[model samples]
Target: MLEVRCLLRSVRFCSSAPFPRHKPSAKLSVRDALGAQNTSGERIKVQGWIRSVRSQKEVLFLHVNDGSSLESLQIVADSSLDSRELTFGSSVEIQGQLVKSPSKRQNVELKAEKIKIIGNCDAKAFPIKYKERHPLEYLRQYPHFRCRTNVLGSILRIRSEATAAIHSFFKDSGFVHIHTPIITSNDSEGAGELFQLEPSGKLKVPEENFFNVPAFLTVSGQLHLEVMSGAFTQVFTFGPTFRAENSQSRRHLAEFYMVEAEISFVNSLQDLMQVIEELFKATAMMVLSNCPEDVELCHKFIAPGQKVISFVDKAQYICCLIISYTEAVEILKQASQNFTFTPEWGVNLQTEHEKYLVKHCGNIPVFIINYPLAIKPFYMRDNEDGPQHTVAAVDLLVPGVGELFGGGLREERYHFLEERLARSGLTEVYQWYLDLRRFGSVPHGGFGMGFERYLQCILGVDNIKDVIPFPRFPHSCLL
Candidate 1:
């Protein structure tokens, strides 16, 4: 009876030994599996859209992409497992053993054990056909599906990395991120190109409007950042800004993202310029280091074989040239190149003038500082230069993108700002802005950067629309 009891106990122990601990589902991203060191012989599940497929009697090959990386993960399947639904653009869930790939394109591939099509795409009717490169302009027509193409995918990935890099730069340097309001009563740029906000349909009286007085989509977040800068010392904001300029040029957009920063107690314009230069260099280096493949893909598709210098290398070697606006006008006027707009002393620098200036400075970023007060907005500090009558303003001109950044020392004097506001007929509208000076004002300054333009500059993309996911221009608001 004791021996029988022992035998029963042994049986019970053996039955409860865990049974190899099978998982419900072991899904791995193509990116993680490809970069995994010891994933060979491991049963892993992958889900992605098929990029291409080649079926044969003995073995079949499938190229799948999950938008995690530039390269597609190759999947090797047996002919018996092949199905008619394994077509291009079809989304599938694959369970397979990871194995070493013999192909030179990738290091590891999946040997499929089971395949299930989650969604089958109709290849015949799909807008993005297989194995054909679509032009950027043609892709813009299908904004909804443009992301499936390799070019757009690459551009977006780089854009995300660039954004993260910018935030990382600021965070590392102890700058606080501020979210400025999208709708406000004051026009930040004072350019009078605001998109006015109103009640639904129509309203009988202005007081019956949503925000009471005139509210508009903000042109810039500079004022809000300045408000935050008073408390945080260093504050920055990244958000959508709107303008109703009605410009159809390649460089104009009705809506875009802006990166604005404000620093308190900044003594001179050089301090602001240093921040801009360092921010650009740091962010460019971070992106180049993290997303070299994406950047390379952009260059390959956008400007084939252009032989442009790497972003990191350019940032390291190219010393940013700081020239006064008066000096820039002199240089542009003396240049042999013909320009559509003549570079006058007080005129704002046109695209042609900016391009000429950058080229004249040996294809490096040029900073034109101390712009004429008459041309700049009212917030720029008035430089006490007698004859020139300039403001402490600056514009950072890059090689491909004419103007990547623009800013200056803000006019923090209460009386000066009040007079300027009254002269611009905006004193009542910006009474709160003047209050910042009245309470506790210090010598502060900042700059604003167009996020899309920065992407175009870094990637060497010619068209602004291609860089931005959804190009918002006049009368062209497509999904």
Candidate 2:
């Protein structure tokens, strides 16, 4: 359902046939055929699966859908064309006359002249039946066929538009897209929750360890993007990240996509926060404009009476709330809501704390900055503030989702990085990273946004698996 057109943008197809041939009839997409204004019936060909079919004494009606659009094209034909192969979930090539529809529901409909059954589907065996709104859990069982549903079709199109919008945002902002490596030697997160790779049925000494040293699926693209930040002033990478945590929480995923960016010459957290705020606003607005109808359909079926887009628009209008992590802890302590974990000055913020902070900040996205140094990773820039020590880190928490983005000013000082890595026993391992600080290192910072969480936040989807196709989690990996 996600066309992934950007992947093919650089590929140019050249067909130089020696002899010219007659042009075939124009084949139109469901979106195209629906938007036609031709009152003077023009012949058009549409190929897609049948969404619904109705047989009457003298007339027949069918709704055909292709992934191009969320709405299906209404087809009206004579009852004489009705056949057993014309059941729901069957693939067909429909040649029809496109004419303006008298119904207010849509602008145009098709009057079928010829119906060719390309593939016949047995309705009884098909998991997805006609006119039944299956819950997301049920649809998830049929991972291979769930995309055919209008709900998933809408979600994927939104995802595609969002991906395109994010790419455009970086391009317009003078940020180079870097394709970071999927396998890395270093654990950027320092969490030790990594998926290590080893060859199957291995025995030889050299082949025992594939890379001689263990390799892991990358947990973050921040380190790789930082390398590019040295050359390119602004660089970004949007790709899959892996974590070996066994959490079955709605937010946790074994494999997911991340949108990470690094900016050079950032003197303060204010500069980094500005970029994060703008990225969210710009991407949201662009996706809304690109796929409004598809988004609306998701709001209708998924959230049911929830104004997902309006809430996103409201967040854009109001300024994102900014507060120190100390302020956040104080706010949590003062609140009446009982938290599962106590909110202390140095402890990490739990989901409950994050949600409460967002609500307390007038229901807008809130940025909590300057986390405790001991709790944060080694890469964060040290505050060097005596008495109460912290790092120049920031986390953006939204209403429904906790910690939408996490970033900080990277430790650009050579001595600080060396000492930290030495303490962690990784000095020789990260010689290349140390080399960056040795020569002309600028004060740079970056943040990574969870792509799936962003989709769930915008679409009001309850589960992370619903938004992404072939979701990889602790115990779930469906084809």
lDDT of 1: 0.87
Off by over 4 Å in 1: 1-25, 201-207
Cα error, residue 449 of model 1, in Å, equals 0.8
Q: How many clashing pairs in candidate 1?
A: 0
lDDT (Cα atoms) of all candidates against the true structure: 0.87, 0.89
| Tens-digit lDDT track of model 1 for 11-125 | 9999987777654447888788898787558888989999998998989999988988888889999988746888899999998888888878889999988888999999888
- Which ranges of candidate 2 are over 4 A from the true structure? 1-24, 201-207, 305-307
- Residues 364-399 of candidate 2: C-alpha lDDT, one tens digit per residue: 889999999989988899999987888999999976
lDDT of 1 at 97: 86
Question: Can you give the lDDT of residue 460 in candidate 1?
Answer: 85
How close is every model to the real structure, measured as TM-score? 0.94, 0.93
In model 2, which residue pairs have backbone atoms overlapping below 3 Å?
Answer: none
